[model samples]
Target: MGRKKTLTCRRWDCEEAPFLGGLCEAHHEEDRLKQLARRAAIDALSTSCIAGKLPEKPGLKDELLRVIRWWDKACLAVNAGRQDNVLLDETQYAPEWCIAFADAIIQEEMNFRQGLDDDATVAFLKKDTWTRFEHLEAGFMSNGVKRPGC
Candidate 1:
């Protein structure tokens, strides 16, 4: 019988035998940690935006832009053959929804600061806005759109 060839890690400069997905155990762990950090950062930004804790203009705008850019990249990845339908839908429309929600919050913040609304009125407005946003998000999820940190 002929001897079988040994497979090595696919990563450059690594000669260790692959443990999973063509990566050595060390490389796999590194990739996992990196993904965790990326997800954590996304979650933090998303939570801030959803809670309306960001300043009305620049802060909200910045977060919206970041999320939009992320979705754009995700869509590009999908186009490059990622083949996740739910991710594709999310990358297509969730950013737009986020923008709309952020714009509404910014407008409400402006009205609140301009003395057009009392504290109680502003609170109710915020509550209503959040409820609507939640409903919209739930609708997307129900339709099989899985957008994390959205």
Candidate 2:
């Protein structure tokens, strides 16, 4: 006979019983918000976000910088109605940021697995990940926009 699956939260590392949709209450809400954030990101990136040119030898940093501003804007718009945590992370990380950062890591891993090591992996590890954040924050703050996530 096949083993029945445990009715725990579907999210990683969470053992709490499911509240809805195979996730605990907190995780369910977070999942909902993450979905919204992702949708917003796709919408903005596809239709409205300013397009950036990729260099012939682009690195993870280049890709990140190209869309970081748009990601931040989309996060704010998507998470605005949530009265609780604006940032998926307690350290003020935007959910969109998390998604893109994870993508960068995954791409690097794939590249490494294929025996195609490059500057991209090193770029992903750089300390200047949030280089443009302060500028965006300043503009949003000066305009009295409600920025979420810390």
Candidate 3:
């Protein structure tokens, strides 16, 4: 009689024997939960996001900068197979849509910062733009904030 080969779990960094669907018990459960939460993972849906040019109001610009930073990083993460971010996953949105939104947001950020004479704003925009999204660095978040999203 020939010896049968042991099948290993096909997930990254998991060498356990296959439990179901070629994944180990833990991975299979994780995938199952992910499949169930897929709908809520997308809070909204749209075929196209215009991301029309940002206006020049201080509050709007400050807020939109945060939004732009988020979408930019999320799109990059999705492209790099790191869809764990809030951006639409590969299964939900098209690559063209992702790239289009990213481009619009980048241009919008530039528009917001291009006219600023302050050196801190310029340096932050050019370099640490990502930092602003989380902690609101280099720019002040205004009060009485009211956007369509909120």
Candidate 4:
């Protein structure tokens, strides 16, 4: 009897040999490309949200920058992968995943603003931005003021 081969990539209908990361070369490349696509999507979404150009809404560049900073801070928690940081599972929340989550939040916020009055929109944006930053800060600091092992 011949030795059975290991499972290949998780991608649909792929048959190539699994490479270093449990993915075949072709599938790996495809995955990489998909990740890049997600990033581009997020970038476009962020830009549109910042510029308020997607739905003919006015942009809030300053608020967008604040949101970006908050996103960056959240990302930093997972920046080191499993090497030193244990707060995040690198595999669970990679850069693409994080950006996608943020993108979704921004999209939803914009969608909500469409139906709201000007004062309501301003209040919503302020509350939303502050909540996100607070959530990130709490999530990152819940264990204590000092970062784990830092």
Candidate 5:
């Protein structure tokens, strides 16, 4: 067997340490506790915001699923080093930013639909939620808007 290398925790300060990827057992336990606490808080907020009843808004649900799928694929690529960088160059960043903005708008529409009792507004909100992604995708720099070598 190869010899083991000694290491310190990556967390700043204090001598209690473990190999490479940081954290002694105690610190690792602490980190897990903190992470769970934060996640619980976020879950509480989401439940409260949705009135403890998350409805099946088809359009918003579909978009959320789509975004989740994209994120999963991106994460896989990142882990495999296929997507090595977050390109924040204007051409790449701008369209992505616009897409995020549009997604927020759709989320607002979904929230409004859930909160309000207006039937007319609900249909319009649903339409807006469905169409926003297309509008955002269109904003992406095709051959025309893209800067060279990007």
Candidate 6:
């Protein structure tokens, strides 16, 4: 009988057995949870954009920003290691380009809430922003970031 081969995780400076995709069990689970959270955050942000209402709940915007930043860090880590598909899965849960768009919407909404005068806020509210937001939301949802209620 042949002995099974022992392989270490591909992630740099680690010596854990490869569980899946050259990552150790810990790294694999961490990456999975990060992707899941990223996808959910993208969906929630898309939902908020579509609704055109800044959620009354505190820290929603902060959470979205944090997730986006985490994504950026993950990408950087992957790039630094020159490892393909290390931090992300095969699924296109959250695209790099869309994060910028999401951030822009978040920033706009935050600015509108914090900096805009009452009249400006009223004028902005009167515009057909909802239609534009809905279009953007539809695009994101269709691209695999699942929309809420669907």
TM-score of each: 0.32, 0.32, 0.29, 0.33, 0.33, 0.35
lDDT of 4 at 126: 55
User: How far in Å is the alpha carbon of 51 misplaced in model 5?
Assistant: 9.1
Best by TM-score: 6
- lDDT on C-alpha atoms for all candidate structures: 0.53, 0.50, 0.45, 0.51, 0.45, 0.50
Q: Model 6, 32-123: lDDT tens per residue?
A: 97776456436644554423565433554564554455455545555565432322341232235445445444444555567743345423
Which portions of model 2 miss their true places by more than 4 Å? 1-6, 49-150
- Put down candidate 4 lDDT per residue, 37-107, tens digits, no spaces: 57654674456442234434444444455556545544665554342133242223334433654454445
Model 5's alpha-carbon lDDT is 0.45
Encode model 2's per-residue lDDT on 81-142: one tens digit a residue: 43222222222345445455534434454465567865554465433435434434454331
TM-score-best of 1 and 4: 4
lDDT of 5 at 122: 41
| CA-only RMSD, every prediction | 16.0, 14.8, 17.3, 9.2, 12.0, 16.2
lDDT tens digits, residue span 1-150, model 1: 433367788776777999998999999999997676455435433554433355454354564455455455545655675633434444455444434444444455566456565346544644554454444446545344444676
2 or 5: which has the higher TM-score?
Answer: 5
Which consecutive 10 residues in model 6 have the weakest lDDT in total?
84-93
Candidate 6 runs further than 4 Å off:
1-6, 49-54, 58-150
Give the least accurate 10-residue stretch of model 3, judged by summed lDDT.
40-49
Q: Which stretches of candidate 3 lie over 4 Å from their true place?
A: 1-5, 43-150
Better of 2 and 6 by TM-score: 6
lDDT at position 101, candidate 5: 30
